[model samples]
Target: MAMTNRDRGGKALELLREGLSPYVERELRRFLGPNVEAEAARLIGEDRYNAGKQLSDLDVAALLKVMWESWNDVFRKTLGFAERSLVSELREWRNQWAHRLRCGQNLSLSDSDPQGLLVKPEVARRQREEEQQTVPAPTGVTSSAATGVTSYAGGESSSPTPAGAPSTTAAPLKRFHGSVALSPLRLGAEAGRIAEEVLAHLSSLPGAQVSVTLEIHVAVPDGVPDQVVRVVMENCRTLKFAVHSFERD
Candidate 1:
């Protein structure tokens, strides 16, 4: 008989635990100090600490979450945006396994492409370059400090300075704002595609300090199962969704 999705998921989970355990422990010890378990407990949980005082005792989500939480402090300088994206993708896959374990459903193999999800750093950088090349620059934008006017597409808006008044046309704004609102992502493929587009956009931005925030509002009817909620909320927490609550009349 062929292995069920649940069995495959279990095997994958086992591999992740065994493969990541020693590396996770070593990194934590190096940065977090000799009492790795004690420090990790503060983030993962006290119960987990008491269970075995090691990363191997925890699940894949816990291990990935630890790396995410410590990324800025330790891993940021060492790893780049591609690595960050991989960690985020791994967290999503781990949560998918969590859902499969509970519902025994067939996994969507298309959404979980190994080539895309496990993209090498050099390939990601090259893709970023290609995406940047394809993005069109803003056109017909011109600013004149002399007349205090900004022109776009042959249309001019004037901010005529009073006699002897100083011109501020060249001054940069205090903040720059840009946003893209995606359609409601229901399927794994939809979410993954949108995520890749957003990453490409971010890669094209000018600065390294660009802050990105993801807001997800899960809308489910009253009859939704506890397992579904558990899995959704687990991924939400993994991604650090700001507010989690039921909104209904």
Candidate 2:
């Protein structure tokens, strides 16, 4: 049997937790010293900790919150602002997946679009054919042969075209790529809205390859040195961030 979206999302969350465990553990240990486990239990849930759950066994949300809440003291040295995008996106995905499982339905387009809205080529072709089957012109319409303009009973008129003008068709776009700078993204509705906008543009153009690079503006602290800036950018690349840059005042 094929894996459902639910299963795939669960696996993705699992992989994310596994990948971040080492880093989360390292930071927590550094910050919390010998009290890492105790503090983690308090932050995540005392019950789970009492039930023998360790940091590695905690959920992705818990791990992410630890890093996010402790960013100033720990994660900020090694990670840049763009990494916040990863944290926000993954946290939202996790939340959506959990909510879907509870509601037994996928999130609405306004909430998320991981699978996207694009149809297959055959479906697109069929849709175009259906749309091209013209409807009968509205009744009581008048055509002005002198100006090539048509007027409807509703008083709406089509734009006048010069008679016998050569018809022109626009060439299909071969590729599309663009980038937009964004402020610090928060979890929940705001992140979902941004994801929806990006996917909506992609879905609009069938058969066109698209790439969207979101440049997240980083507001560095008062005293973060140049060396820390280099480390942040390097760490972003090591973690497979596709495009990143850093600037200091």
Candidate 3:
């Protein structure tokens, strides 16, 4: 008998868990070494004496989220082409089917694909790039150094969109500003996680423009950790957004 979508989803989840667990552990060790174990223990608690033992106890979903939030650096730097897609598709699968043990979508929708993984990230990136290239921004937006909001109601741009391409317009670009407070005790990478979450929330709001530019403001104190800065910048860039890190006394 042919496998149902649910059955396939279940199997996919199994593979995802099996495949990602070791990858996560190996990368964690490679990047941060013993730091990874302590971090993992902190997230889910140190009920188990050994970090590996504790990690094994975490289910796939929790593990995925924790890894993304805490190991943003490793994901960006170390993960290879195929491994990256696997993580991306795993993320999508998790979100679409959060409640059920198995998301109802077939993990391998294509026959050529291996083990229901290996999604092409380029297709999505190219589509977004094209959309961004075509969105027409209103002219004359000046930033008030005080408020940081870009005003776009001034004179129009002298140059026009290159002819022969479809044109699109929106009211104007509003300079979006957001900040998140970081706890020194927690994984500084959480700043990046929070920024990504904020970006997701803003994009989802009603009346939000289809194409948007966001400037994430992160306030850092003296002696800020490198991980915090790296993760926040990397995450914002991944979303095609900008980040401003402001240091204050």
**What is the RMSD, in Å, between candidate 2 and the native fold over all Cα?**
15.3
- The CA lDDT at 7 in model 2 is 60
> Per-residue lDDT for 39 in model 1?
60
Q: List candidate 2 segments past 4 Å from native.
A: 45-52, 101-249
User: 197-236, model 3: which lDDT tens digit per residue?
Assistant: 5555566678775443433344544666888769967876
Q: All predictions: root-mean-square deviation over Cα?
A: 20.0, 15.3, 14.8
Local distance difference test, each candidate: 0.60, 0.60, 0.56
Runs in model 3 deviating more than 4 A are 45-53, 80-89, 101-179, 182-188, 204-249
What is the C-alpha lDDT profile of model 1 across 1-249, one tens digit per residue? 677665576577678767987777777777878667776776565433234545666766678777766665556657787887888777766655543324555433333333312223344345445765887534446667787667655374556678889866644323334455566533333444445545544555676345666666565666668787798789878977787755454
**Clashing residue pairs found in predicted model 2:** none
Predicted structure 3: lDDT? 0.56
lDDT of 1 at 5: 62
Please give the TM-score that candidate 1 achieves against the real structure: 0.39
Model 1: lowest-lDDT 10 consecutive positions: 111-120
Task: Give the clash count for model 3.
Answer: 1
